[model samples]
Target: MVHGGFRVWSGSEPDFPRQAEQVRSLLGAPDNPALLPPQFVAAALTGIGGMLITRSRADALVDAAFALPTRDPSVILAVRHAANRPGATRLTLVARDRPGAPDGTLVDLPTDWKAQESVFATDSIAIGEPGSEHAKQARQLQGQIWQSPPDNLYPTWLYAPVCPASMSLVALHGDRVVGFLLGFQSQPDRDGTTVLESQVMGVDPDYRNRGIAVHLKHQQAIMAGMLGIDAIRWTADPLQAGSALLNFGRLGAFSRRFLPDYLPFRNELNRLPASRLRIEWTVAGEDPRTELSQHRLHLRESVVPGTTCPIANDGPMDLQITPGNPLIAIEIPSDWTALQQSDLATARAWRTNLDDLLLRCLGEGPDQYLITNAVIHRGRVFLLAEQATNNLLRLYS
Candidate 1:
């Protein structure tokens, strides 16, 4: 996952300053493109890497709504991300009106929505499938999710249904696009395919919490089930506690496959070792939850902390690697994102240490370990593992 940076020029001169200044104005006045000029939109698209986040849900919705041109008759509410906010929250604009203006169908949007210091959504948000018009916005958000260049974004082919190979969904508050999830049918290898691969998912920085991201995954899984897919496979960053809890605790997907440097570090927000664990969700059956619930029991094991500490910490314990144990546990920092921001050098050291320790414990080659479960208790994050053994049910006893 990567995104490319851009350099902007107007005519013969490199007018980055004017373009940058204009971007600031246009984001707030997306409805009033005349407030600045469409040229700024073009410039931000071609200028340095940027993100346009609004101060609140109301602001974002208003900004997106402003994208609606008064004359367009066929277009409905147009929600799109603006590619022009470097070192700032990328802006998304609402460009038009919905057909027939049916009210009360979508989640009721409040007229006096409050501005928020933090970008996140409450439980009262709307989730639905987006049209091809949203392809650019989705691509931009996907790239930013990886903290990569916009050029690294997914092409329209993957999202717009022209290929009929993937399912794309987004969450919104009014016209403001808050979150998205993309899953595509896994290509037929030599064995043929029966699974869908969840490729990329992201929530607006301000519109997290309230289980918005998890709901997106849930909806995608349901859609896959409708399409007669049997399974869904995806990767998760091992260092993140919140993500671990959601995937393992809430969703019940399990894994033992540990991949190092699967995603390269970039941008401050994404700085960390590129290690990730594989996750699989089997969709078919009368109740997928039954098998998943049983698997959860097998993966849950009592742990002696610090026994397999991947990185040094000043916590309650300093430990050693345990080998041949039917069940294994690895420790990770409590809040990796905060650790990266507050102490970057230390974070990198943690990444280097993880690279060494995880490889030693899980094995460096592919399919070495199957990450079965993860938990956070007593302010520590532990990933449960066992060699690629399938008799996990026996190990539980």
Candidate 2:
């Protein structure tokens, strides 16, 4: 079991090896030595054998990092970052972990800075492929964007553009990149009907509430139209009232397909049974924007909401879901984000219940019911999707 100066871990070894073993088990791979870098393993051993750090302290440190609600393997990145830094223990230890990343400009850009088309431009932020001068700044921004408000952990999946076809647009404020559209053009269908999947799009918290998200989305649509993509599909937590308003009310996207626990609940901001509603931005369909506008007006005018599911501060539960009603309305939390922060247990309960109800409302495919609009009335939010024909695809046609 001995390897020159150090022997491999045995169950007999005290604190470090045992604690390391604990971390390994928590990681769901007790026998996998590949889980950690050699330095981390050595650090644990040195601390254990030397009796420099207590098991309690070691346990606390390990738990906090493993507790990141992520299986991103960047937990090791967090560890490596911590180990490399000689000083600034508090800063390093408290730092958000990342996967193995490189410094300097990325070498794998799909399109050159000059050749990439400029999608959108406002007085403040412009969306395009930024030049090399902004790489390090962009890197720093990526790390900071998650720790901010609105949506945190979702941005972790979007660490610089992962998709193809130049859907990777960066929002630049002067020389610094403030927002990023980590999107990509998905594969074409049989008729070559293109689809653009918006993986993750976010503006810096400091730069939010300024219509930056709107600008990015609009620019993406323009780009999609130019490329002749039929629709843009994206997923979002149905609890986000603001996002619901923007996507359904403003951007003309609808949730006809409800995916139960589709997103992994690994992020701190996320709740259990991570259900998401797939938003379809039908760019070329029967004018969703115009229909949405009319739907909004109708919601305000005279159309009575047939069914209502009462949702409380604790979350939606013990509910009544009326499927056959022409216009069914399900009440949602006014501020689900705040609700999750205050009491997550209630949030989890709400998520689990909402999953089945939403799915029942919006069936599987073109053969099922389709959602038309989302309306907010009298401090209550209602999903406005009439039970369409059995062949729902006809509505799109």
Candidate 3:
């Protein structure tokens, strides 16, 4: 009756059997239908019903045959209803397995599950301000000045700007000063916008967890926003996981560049492994500020390739720069192995150079001449200093 397909008025009609046979033949079925697992049978019937109903078949026979009186007959009923009504589609069954089978089963997902956003907001905490109990505590717990010379004394402020008001501090409670953030404001980026640069962060041994660092970082971001600053930038120690994650993962900072063994005072500080990672948080571009915040400097590979400068065709040159001088550039073997790999003589020669350079820089003043950059190409070491006038190499001995 519809679309030239078979039509039926009721289940008991004589034409129903003929139409059912026709539907079964269209589906490539045998004269005697095989008994299938309930789920398989239900799924097959549903598919057939959909196709038959879409053709505008007027026969109610297809519906009646599909709707068998049995337990869990919803599938058949659903398919039958869909076939009889115009534009009616039955709900799909996404079962993982067929009936009477035990391998895979259907699963229902929780309705209340939700994901957290990448950026988050929180309250601000004042840092480095006068009368801040945390700052005072940090000052009190400051480590002793190791190997201090006649002029320098204990508790000497290693790095400066020495202002109690401008500097910010993250208060950490633990064995020693386990975690602390120290930062100061710096000149604005291109747009005449002010920014805060976190100088250093120290985490004590015992209190690594408790999310104290996260709390401190959140507060810092909030303060940066409130201070009308357009961005926040900082250098991180790449080896530290907590520090790295806080800046890169949580804060959404990206790494821009790497500086290898960028600090000369490392030896004087008992050879503490230190690398510089530049990270920035921009405020204007997107909500909650988005910017590359983590840069890790791979020291050995970056500074001294193959572990040492190669022996040049012209041989090594005697390089000399006076005390208080900014930098002393030297030409050494480019293909030479690393200091550890080099012969004792070669290693001692470079160590001597470093010793002389450091002593000269130390003579200038305390906390001077930090090795800010290093580059290794074809086995040559290029070291750059933070100060051109007051050398840092002289501060040690």
- The candidate that wins on TM-score is 2
Off by over 4 Å in 3: 1-133, 140-165, 172-178, 267-273, 283-397
Ranking by TM-score: 2, 1, 3
Q: What is the lDDT of residue 145 in candidate 1?
A: 61
Q: Which of the two, 2 or 3, has more lDDT?
A: 2
Count of clashes in candidate 3: 33
lDDT for model 3: 0.37
All-Cα superposition RMSD per candidate:
13.8, 12.5, 30.4
Q: Model 1: how far is 303 from its true place, Å? A: 6.2
Per-residue lDDT of model 2, residues 125-232, tens digit only: 777754434433444564464343222222222232422223556688877778776554454546755667676666777888878777778777877787677788
**Candidate achieving the largest lDDT:** 1
The digit string of per-residue lDDT tens for model 3 on 121-191 reads 22322223222334434444333222322211111121122331134444433223334555544534456
- Runs of candidate 2 with Cα error greater than 4 angstroms are 1-119, 132-166, 285-315, 364-368, 390-393
| TM-scores, all models, native as reference | 0.59, 0.61, 0.35
Clashes of each: 30, 1, 33
Error of 1 at 219 (Å): 1.4
lDDT of model 1 at position 336 = 81
Arrange candidates, best lDDT first. Answer: 1, 2, 3
